[model samples]
Target: MTVQTIPAPAAPLRVTPASPLFLREDEIRRGIELLYFGYTAMIRGADAILEAQGLGRAHHRALYFIARQPGLSVGELIGLLGITKQSLGRVLTELQARALVEQQVGTADRRQRLLRLTKAGAALEARLFGELERSMARAYGEAGQQAVTGFWAVLMGLVPPDDRPRVEALQA
Candidate 1:
């Protein structure tokens, strides 16, 4: 007997907001500009320090997440980074070559490779985090408690729904 297969329907189009809640185009544009500048400034704050070590944003992010969740597996790091395995591999290779990160076989699963920051890595991460904290502290202080909370909410909301669980797990 021959079997027939049905194709899946295409996803529905996204709806644009029509109410007062929608932001003006100019306002939206300004918000985008602000985000760009804010991110640039935030990275610049740590760039000098990272530059001294010949590292970049990818290295910093890997260190940050590994420091945050010690013993995180290589697979988990790749997922959390949202980067290709090749990209992550380069970063991990650099970090490992610099003696900043250590990887060991997982106790529960021998096939899994667990990662941790070495003492040097922790120190570097702390310094990078300190630079970030200086700027973040000032921003949060100026923004006030409510704004700070709102900022976190907005940032969290920007994360993909599918990745929220992984983010929440890290937060916990």
Candidate 2:
């Protein structure tokens, strides 16, 4: 007797409010306001520390991402940060001068520069993350698991369709 294999069923479509359905201006405005406030609140802690170090949000963002992705190429950073080369060059120069970051020529491609954080950079990144974590932890704890999951889905949905894969890859 010969046995045939059965294919698994396809996943069901997920319908969300974020879908391309019509939305009221008032609702959209509310979401925009919430995003503004959330962003401001999240950065406030890190901003204080960065300010004291003569750094700004841009510097902190670079440090945070570099710490997340060690040995990331200069081009990769520019793509991820979505900033102009000039802006990134300025930030990198500052970071290099401070000895917080180091760059090495890629083995495979001599022209490509791989970026890594120094011991000092890691320590500062940890300190910066600590403050932000405290705030997020408190908010997440209050929101509970379900809300947290939904919140992440909403945030991820905000990313452009073309850029979603890149952002999701970073999560991995």
Candidate 3:
């Protein structure tokens, strides 16, 4: 039999005084602006890459999420992407035609069509998404410690508090 090891948890520490930070309004505004700037640059890069392949962001989003949860139903993908049915249909058609994604009927629910990535699709997503991830990481690193952590906090706040549990569960 194979053995497994798990690390023990550390004991809780007592409260301590932290460094004081004077965050001015202008500085906070700049922080928000940097968030916008960073997002725009990242999107521009991803758009160019997708355009080169004659695909769009919608396609990228669809492929990216579906890859994470293979066999996702059309309805489920619709919910995740939060796009109009017509818009999604267009992208799904293109993906299906290219054999990047395949749709199969749900076993119990005949009306539902489940989507999954083919080997080629997963490979393509990895190549494209790898670039996006690296670029984003570099950009955030350049933004320094405060902006990086602050930006994460801001983005996390964008999601509703009620939905946080659901989001955390999914990531878990």
Candidate 4:
């Protein structure tokens, strides 16, 4: 039997350079729309994977952060996610129930709970990240190095000044 191969996607349209009046309302709206749509597209594949596992974006976010810092505390996760304790508690409970995560009492503070991923959790996180990395790599390759740097700068500008340190710490 002959095998069939799907065609590659068409090249993206050429994006116009920003006008001198980039601060105008139309330009700002364009930026906002692009950000919303771009993010939605980027996460679409991961969302499907999460849905198949009976999970949601919040669960994915928790898995990602927990993977990033294996011994992340419950309080620190709440802070990083900027989510309510009740909301996080629900997500963590579900994750633990699925044997995807484990929590241990902090060595220094008996009252504190530190979070870590199970082997299963790590596998799931890696799959999710693979989907994201593929999308990002394609976009970055299309945009090139200079545009990628500018994109990072624009995203950083969106973060509050006080939160910059927390974000910067992740780079280390």
Candidate 5:
């Protein structure tokens, strides 16, 4: 005798009108407005901390991520950030000119350069951590654990599967 088994039904996803995704046209418009406001406020907060140090978000991203994983290749950074080659080149030039980053010739590949944060760059990263962590902590405190987890889940959903490991490695 042969037996056949049926797969179980998938669980339903929970979403609300306030969620930018499932909302109707009018609701989506309102949600977009809120998102714009929130993003603007967050950038403003970040800028306030960054401006004093003469560093902007782009430099901050490079410094922080490079410090997180020293010796990460330029190719790896470009892949993780998903920016155009020209845009990344400009940022790299700025960082290198400032002596915040150093490029070492790849051991195996002569043409390839591996990037690392210089001592100054690592110090800047360590300094920025306090302010960044405080801001994020305050946001999490206001949002609560469930909201924070949900927000992370929504963000992770936006990323492709193959890119998830790179993001997770940074988090680690």
Candidate 6:
């Protein structure tokens, strides 16, 4: 049997402008499709790295947030990740066992556990972030400042108002 290969597109696909009535079904579907495909493409590189290290997206999410806010409490991480305590426990356990993360007792609350990335974890996180940054930077460059701002606005709109503060805190 002969193997067949699909040829890559010769150029990037042209972006279609949203309809004046962006709330139309076609426009809404296009937005959903773009979000899905764009996110998949953006995370593809980081996914490979995670797989090579025997980790998954959950582990990456934990590492990423911990790296962003060292000493983040386990409770806070659970809130941020929107994961069950048991799920977070497993991810944290594996991370600590692999020497990619560490947890310290909270200063004020002895029962609270705070999370931080180990040096190796930081290095790995940086590499993964580098992959994401490159992809986002390229897309942002192509989209220009106004378009990027609009994109951010659209994304922010998708977040529930109650949860916006939690997401905004990441920018701090």
Clash number by candidate, in order: 0, 0, 0, 0, 0, 0
Candidate 5 residues 1-172, lDDT tens each? 1212322224323334365455579775765675688666655655766788777888778777788888888888888777877888898999899898999998998778889988887777776765565555656655655777877886787678987898898876
For candidate 4, what is the TM-score?
0.90
Which pairs in model 4 have colliding backbones? none
Using lDDT as the yardstick, the better of models 2 and 3 is 2
Give the per-residue lDDT of model 3 (tens digit) for 51-161. Answer: 889998889999998887888799878877789899899999999999999989999999999999999999888877776776766654455555557656767787889
Instruction: Name the candidate that leads on lDDT.
Output: 4
Models ranked on TM-score:
4, 6, 2, 1, 3, 5
Question: What are the C-alpha RMSDs, in order, of all predicted structures?
Answer: 15.1, 10.5, 7.7, 5.3, 11.3, 7.6
lDDT score for candidate 3 against the true structure: 0.76
Error of 4 at 35 (Å): 0.4
Model 3 TM: 0.74
Q: Global lDDT for candidate 6?
A: 0.89
How far in Å is the alpha carbon of 68 misplaced in model 1? 0.5
Candidate 2 Cα errors over 4 Å, as ranges: 1-22
> For model 2, where is the 10-residue window of minimal lDDT?
1-10
> What C-alpha lDDT, on a 0 to 100 scale, does residue 100 get in candidate 3?
97
Weakest ten-residue segment in model 1 by summed lDDT: 1-10
lDDT of 2 by residue, 1-172 (tens): 1212322224322323454643778668867987899889988998889989999888888998999999999999999999999999999999999999999999999999999999999989998998787777766655555666887988989998999999988887
Query: How much is 155 displaced in model 6, in angstroms?
Result: 0.4
lDDT of 4 by residue, 67-129 (tens): 998888999999999999999999999999999999999999989999999999999999999
